[model samples]
Every structure is written in C-alpha cells, then in structure tokens.
Target: MAHANTVLINALRRTANKLSSGTSYQWGHMGSCNCGNLAQELTLLSKAEIHEFAMAGRGDWREQVEEFCPASGLPMDLLIAEMLKNGLTTTDLQHLEKLSDRKILAGIPSEIRSKMKYNSREDVILYLSTWANLLEDELLEAAPSLESLLKWEEPIPIPEDILL
Candidate 1:
C-alpha cells in the first residue's frame, strides 16, 4: 500500500472529482485514463502533457510502472517519480491503471465492488474515491492521540535564572 498521507488522499479525491465533473476520459488514452487523471492532479500537468510524456515510453502505465527507473530521467519515469515522492507506490500505479488493488477493492461495498469495471469512468471514480477514503482512514489510525501526546517523553528543563 502507498504511504498514508494527505497529499495522496487529496490528489485521489480531486482526480475523482474532476472525472465526476466530466473531464475527458478514455481507457485507451494514456493522458486520460485512470492513472493519467491522477498524474494530472499530482503533477499539475494537462492531459496533453501527460500524453506527451507517456509517448516517450513503449507501453502503458502498468508496464511503465513495472519497469520504472527513478534514475533514468525519462519524462514518464520522472513523472512517475513525482508521484512516488508524493506517497504513491509503483504497485499503486499498476493497480490504479487496472483497478485491481486487493485492499482498495475490498474497501468498496461488495455490491458496488462486484459491478466495477476497470475501464469504466464511473468505476474509476469509485476506485479513486474509495482509495482516498482508505488512505484517510489509515492516516487517522496512524496519528498519535492526545493521550499519547500527553505521555510523550520527558520535557526540557527551564533555567531558574530566567524564570518569571
């Protein structure tokens, strides 16, 4: 799973919202597909820019992710590196492209999950929104509670000479 963080969660949600508001979407287009929309949100790049970047590679998002080399400096690789730096994992990209992450899939309601088609825009929206919610939950679970904060290690001593 990708690291639980607000950046990834918000980007996922914004991408879903963009799609819901009728952004261009096509499973066959590298710039407008599932991962492409997210790339747009994360990289602040347009669909045309994403498509141009992807053209530097030989395969689709899934294949590129599988073969990613952060040090390679290819435009697509660099774009992918941006996403990873912001909290996404290569596996997350692969699953986003295919809508097949087991945990993300399980997070969706069973009835709706059963009907989700990987390439459908509506299904992609569901997947992204569900992913965002999952990450948000994970982030909340990982945060230190007030009780834990109150119990945090010994406090630093104050100098008596300067005391008020």
Candidate 2:
C-alpha cells in the first residue's frame, strides 16, 4: 500500500475527478491509462509527455515497471523514478495499471468491486476514489492529536518496587 500523505491523496482524488468529468481514458493508450493518469497527477506531466517516455521503453507500464532502473537514464525509467519519488512503489505501479492492488480493492464495496472492469472508465474512477479514501483514512490515523502535539516532557515515575 502507498504511504499516506495529503499530496498523494489529493492527487488520487483529482485523478478520479478528472476521469469522472470525462478526461480521456483509454486503457490501450499508454498516456491515458490507469497508472499513466496518476503519473500525470503526480508529476504534472501531460499525457503526450508520458506517452513519449513510455515509447522510449520496450513495453507497457507493467514491463516498464518490472524493468525500472532509477540509475538508467532511459526516459521511461526517469519517469518511473519521478513517480517513486512521489511515494509510489514499483508494486504500486504494477497494481495501478491493472487495478489489482488488493488493499485498494478491499476498500471498494464488494458488489461494485467484484464487477469492476479494469478497462472501464467508470470502474477506474471508482477505484481511484476508493484508493484516495483509503489513503485519507491512513493519513488521519497517523496524525498526532492536539494534546500529544502540545504536551511537554514529564518526569517518569519509577516503579515502587524498583525504588525500594
């Protein structure tokens, strides 16, 4: 699962919104595909730029991910590096392209999740929203309470037995 952060969570929602509002979604298109769209949101790159980077490599997102090497100067590798720097793992990239992340999938309602088609824009939108929600929950859970943040250090009370 992705490490939850506000930026990544917001990006996921924005991607979902873009899809919901009819942003171009074609599973076959390298730039507009599932991972591609998220990459766009994360890296602030256009679809054409993403597509071009992918083309410089030999395979689809899955293959590119499998072969990802941060040290390599290949365009696709560089692009994937940027996505990683934004908090995604290679496994996450693989799952994003296929909507196969079990954690994210589990966040969706069973009825809709079970029927989801990886290539369908509606399904993609739903998946994105669910992922964002999951991340938001994670972010909240990890946040410090106001009392904890404002607390000052206190003296530890030694156990009575140890003091004796």
Candidate 3:
C-alpha cells in the first residue's frame, strides 16, 4: 500500500506540474480572446470594475462599490464559494459535498469546459488542482516500487503507419 501510494504521488505530481504550467499559457490565451465572447451579452460590469471604483474613490468606497456591483454574473467569488460547497477544495476527501446553491453564478469560463458546458475555467482549474493535491498525498502514502510504477497495461499493436 505504501509503495502504491508513492508511485501514485509521483505520477500525480508530474501531472499536476504539467497541468499548472500549461494552465498559465492557456489562461492567458483565454482571457485575451475569450473574454469578449463570454461577456458579449453581459451588461453588468465585473467585480474588477467595482474594485477599480473602490480604488479610485476618495474614501471608504468599498461598501458603496459592493452595493453597486453586488457580483451578479459569473466570477471567481461565486465559483470559489461553489467549489467550497461541492467539497472540491484540497480539504475535501470523499468528494461528496453538495452542489453549491449558486451553481448558475458559478458558470465555467474555459473554452474546454464551456464546450463541455460545465463550470467556468477558474472552477475547473481549482477542481483539478484540488484533486491533484489530494492524489499527491495518496502517492506519498503508497510508496510503490519503480518497477510496479512503470508497468501500466501494454498498448495493443498498431498499424505501422499509425505508430508514433
């Protein structure tokens, strides 16, 4: 069991590193190109707008901005809250938490999850990060041998032209 845990942890760490590194580029691309598409129909300004307003205000504008913006559409706050409720954070183990009451507000932002019609990009990232962290712990617990680690089910033979 310890061996299995170690192998799994290493695999998970590799996967998480890959995912996190790729995610920065992916997020940059999405924000640049996709935000316009996502916000096309949204008349409401984002929380960033509210923040800017607060920053620009003479004194104690946070409250006024909070009242003004109120975080209507899809954003991180709603997304994080939902993630917390769903038990998708690092602390969650059984993956049995209830769906957030603000599921609609927690709409997914990524082109991938969007096409899949799931949660927003931020939500998906958080979800995967949480799982990856958990799997890392599991790997540490297992501590599998390298031989057992390397042995996955063999791939079936492919045609010569199709082989990579």
Candidate number of the best TM-score: 1
Please report, as a residue range, the 10-residue window in candidate 2 with the lowest summed lDDT. 149-158
Candidate 1 has which clashing residue pairs, if any? Answer: none
Candidate 2, 59-147: lDDT as tens digits? 99999999998888998899899888777889988988889999999888898888988999999898889988988888888899899
lDDT scores of the candidates, listed in order: 0.92, 0.89, 0.33
Worst 10 residues of 1 by lDDT: 149-158
Deviation from truth (RMSD, Å), model 2: 5.5
Model 2 clash pairs are none
lDDT of 3 by residue, 98-155 (tens): 1121332234335533443222444433443444455555555667778887887987
- For residues 58-126, could you state the per-residue lDDT of candidate 1 as single tens digits? 699988898899899899999999999999999999989989999999988899989889999999999
Rank order (by TM-score, best first): 1, 2, 3
Q: Which candidate ranks first by lDDT, i.e. highest?
A: 1
Stretches of candidate 1 exceeding 4 Å from the true structure: 150-156
State, as a TM-score between 0 and 1, how close model 2 is to the true structure.
0.90
Candidate 1 local accuracy as lDDT? 0.92
Compare candidates 1 and 2 on lDDT and give the better one.
1
